[model samples]
Target: MHGGTVRPRRGWGGVPKINVYLPDDLAEGVRAAGLPVSAICQRALEASVRRVAAIRRTALSAHEDPTAGLNQFTDRARTAIRTAAGRSRAAGGQLGTADLLHGVLDEGANLGVRVLRALGLDPAALAAALPQRPQDPVGAASFTATASAALELAVTEALALGHDFVGCEHLVLGLLAEPDGSAGALLRDRGADLRPARQAVVAALVGLTRAAPDPLHPVLARLDRLERHTGLAP
Candidate 1:
């Protein structure tokens, strides 16, 4: 690991080369001029990393995540958030996309779990795929930048679905929205894409849609569901 980032052996001394493409003419000219392209690229990437790190720090430095303003999370969603935070703490790392996935699976009774099962994605396997150690360490914070972004996306998903409260299924959708994030990548690699997962959610909740008084009908119904709540799914 070079500077906390895993690198493949490519350049001298186990350094990885980030390929920089250039037009033939430009490449020829640069080669003729013997320009230090590697150094230039390193400098540019470092500057970009600094800027991104600053933005992330700004987002997470607040004691409470801005998503708290849209606090219409159902019981399972709230529990999942708390569970994710707890796992992050126990792992000695900041809350991240993987932790959020873990939270959903940990709860074991949410629509999130059902969606995974319906997709033929094993929740246990997904949880096992989570890195035992933090992938990249960002300093102390309630949630990583990716995690915070996913939470915002979760609210968006809930709103788009015409639901009054956020559900664990929405959290799954949020994580999927951030495909560059760790857990998102894991899910995508396993063929659990967004549309099909939502299809699964809709299928499970179709029975509860009629004559419901509030938007929380699906979420509450899922939580209070006792049939196959432990090992079985929705």
Candidate 2:
């Protein structure tokens, strides 16, 4: 693939012209997230394309694909957020990250929540504890950068261990693995001990490998079982 100056391709009968104008705050967020504006746009577009491809692949699978049906939650979350934001704005309220997290919870993705439960972490709890936005203008960029880096490291760990997809377990592992991350520090401040949890995850992964199943499959399957055990429905 070319690194730069790649032209957009014509598709869907003809090339469609599109433009995205980032708000000043959002543009700052992109920069704070340690991504150039172009990189941010490219990744967002790529994810959308890959999601559609994943749906098509799911439709071709004979066995049940949990991810196939799970994607509706994104659209539902987005719609709920838009609706809530509209109402809030009508009432002269400003929308923020708390509103977004609430929207995600409102979509009721049990599978997602289950994974969090498996790690003894709750998104709702984290959402409540997290600052919706940084109060200090000077630290806003650094705060987001730290969060982004933690997320990236967590994802990288999963992939490096031969995992095929990311789930809530990865998020937990990421937080626990990153001693210097904001989320990790917060968890520590709340008296959560990650050392034991990390050892347990490592042991479980080793045991899973000894069972002779596809390594990635077991990781994902174990995660699913953990979800069900926690009473989260797919």
lDDT of 2 by residue, 96-191 (tens): 333333334444453333444455667678668754433222211111334334435445545433444444444455565666655566656655
Top-TM-score structure, candidate number: 1
Supply the global lDDT for candidate 1. 0.69
Question: After TM-score superposition, what is the CA distance of residue 57 in candidate 2 from its true location, in Å?
Answer: 26
TM-score of 2: 0.35
Residue 9 in model 1: shift from native, Å?
52
Can you write out model 1's per-residue Cα lDDT over 1-234, one digit (the tens) per residue? 112234445888867765665656556766788989878667655644443343244333324442333346778877887667656765566788988898898899988898888888999999889877453433444688798788767766665454556789989999999867899999999998897876676665654554463884655465434222222235
Residue range with the least summed lDDT across 10 consecutive positions in model 2: 134-143
How many clashes (backbone atoms < 3 Å, residues ≥3 apart in a chain or on different chains) does model 2 have? 0
Error of 2 at 41 (Å): 31
RMSD of each: 16.3, 16.3
